[model samples]
Target: MTAAAIGASFRPNELEVRPDGSGNLLGSLCRSCGAHFFPIREACAGCLSEDLKTVRFATEGTLYTYTIVRQSTPAFEVPYALGYVDLPEGVRIMGQITGVEFSDISIGMPMVLVLEPFGTSEAGDALTGYRFRPADVTSD
Candidate 1:
């Protein structure tokens, strides 16, 4: 696919897929309180300040917690791994866990963000999204 097509984000406000095929999760950084929030909040929850800036979050993080999802809406597959990843910015992001099995995931494991094809848009174009994988794992 062309870079323009591949860079189409599943959730444009949350993920940014660059032309070089690299990407970062986007969030809001509170300049007033030095706090960070995922999903790009308009205000700081800590200080209730509107002085927030859009920032790209670090790809590396620690797996804080997780669960095996055996049930979900038709849009999602069953028995997928889900987890909270604590980034260096002190924000915890919930995402699907990949590159590791459900039985192998553990608390405090090093994780890294990975961009992939999520699903097709209404126009049948590919949409990019993110998943967290063990940092030690490499794509085959």
Candidate 2:
């Protein structure tokens, strides 16, 4: 696979699109306390550790809580599932849900992060981004 095959990351700092079409959500890990923070925190919230390192989070997680948003802002459409997933690294992340029927989504289900084209840049270039789907689901 090549970088051209998968497109570029929507937000390079938050989402990293690997050449193989798979990607990981980017976060910061506290070197001192092992605490992980999403969106790359400047300091560890749990232990107040300033020595943080960038890390790619595990793609798999467990759905902790969710909401089916029937309405949203212009950038997002309605009838989307928004959820909080608990990663094994001890971080809770919020992302859009995909690849499952609205009624089929449930708390505690196994989830896996996926990368897809999110939108276009000002130059009209494709921007790859991350979302979550049921672990058992197949992609088209």
Best TM-score among the predictions, by candidate number: 1
Point out where model 1 deviates above 4 Å.
Answer: 1-7
Over 4 Å off, model 2 = 1-3
lDDT of each: 0.92, 0.90
Query: Candidate 2's residue-wise lDDT over 1-113, tens digit each?
Result: 47676878988999888788888898999999888889898988889888999999999999999999988889887889999999999889999999999899999999999
Question: How displaced is residue 53 in candidate 1, in Å?
Answer: 0.7
Models 1 onward score TM values of 0.93, 0.92
Query: How would you encode candidate 1's per-residue C-alpha lDDT over 1-140 as one tens digit per residue?
Result: 55765748899899988987799999999999899998899899999999999999999999999999999999998989999999999999999999997889999999999998898889988888999999998986
